[model samples]
Target: MDHVNISVANNEEKGANVDFDYSQRAQWLRAAVLGANDGLVSVASLMMGVGAVKQDVKAMFLIGFAGLVAGACSMAIGEFVSVYSQLDIEVAQMKRDHITNHDQELAEKENLPSPFQAALASALAFSLGAIVPLLAAMFIDSYKVRLAVILAAVSIALVVFGAVGAVLGGSSRVKSCVRVLVGGWLAMAITFGLTKLIGSSGLQM
Candidate 1:
């Protein structure tokens, strides 16, 4: 009877640990998907806006590169600050709870969010997403072809990202893909239309 009880308790503990690990994985995946989507949409829109006003390949490359660098840095800094704040709150809570055992406190701190890790992950995800449009337009010389390729590449990327996110999150893949695709199209279209309209008004630079 004692052996059976011990085995059951150990099995329960193992199951709980697995659940905790899975939850952590889900949270990480969610963050990565969101960061990548933001980077893809923002950089692609910026490129489309620039392409609308100026068909120069140099101009498009410059704008896309600038957007990637700026977006990555912004994401890294924002994530670092946000995660650091959360870490502070968690540490404070632990203190309030009067965790007396050093080993216990250390274990809790180990599980706390690492601001550096979060920042790096955010930056890398943004850069990865921002590279799609840049690479799509890189070899294409014709202005119209470049724009079309960029749109195509970005649309494909958006769909892929959405599908991956949906799979990991256990959501409806069709809905997720459609939502991401539509949102990306709207963003690029709006930026292009607005920039073209403004440029038509004889705005310089």
Candidate 2:
């Protein structure tokens, strides 16, 4: 009787509180952040490069649009394939675990992966990010102003994305923001420099 009471007390104590895990959400958040970062950096870099070579508004806008569409599609497909493979492996493992060990508790504990949701998040995030540079280039008529606006917009976006990623991933916000901002600036600088050099060398494109 005493042992039974002790066991009951222990059970009650163990059930006092539950921990909510954010690790799963973190995985999808990571995918979304990557997509957004890629969209912002790649499209911005492309625009900066094109602007450096030719100040034609139409040419710059066309390239930016093309990049956005291509990037979003690529992000969606890549995320879907990558996460789908992970889901498949997880499902297979779960099946094997059930068959070999008859582990109901383990199966119940393992949450099902959502590749579709992740892919959608990634694609949408990419599109949303691509819009920033596109919008900056679209509304401004002056070539120099458009270019400056794109860089400024990208800088702000990188900082914002970094902070968001850090918050979602539970890390240092300032560090994350600075890191993303610096990386984006470097990418734009490199692209612009290369394109400028090539254009100056009498390369027609």
- Best candidate according to lDDT: 1
lDDT of 1 by residue, 108-186 (tens): 9888988888888888888989999999987888999999999999999999999998887768999999999999999
Per-prediction TM-score to the true structure, in the order listed: 0.89, 0.85
Runs off by more than 4 Å, candidate 2 = 1-19, 99-110
List, residue by residue over 14-81, the lDDT tens digit for candidate 2. 65522233555666888889989999999999999999998988898899899999998888888888
The deviation in Å at residue 105 for candidate 1 is 1.6
What local lDDT does model 2 show for residue 60? 85
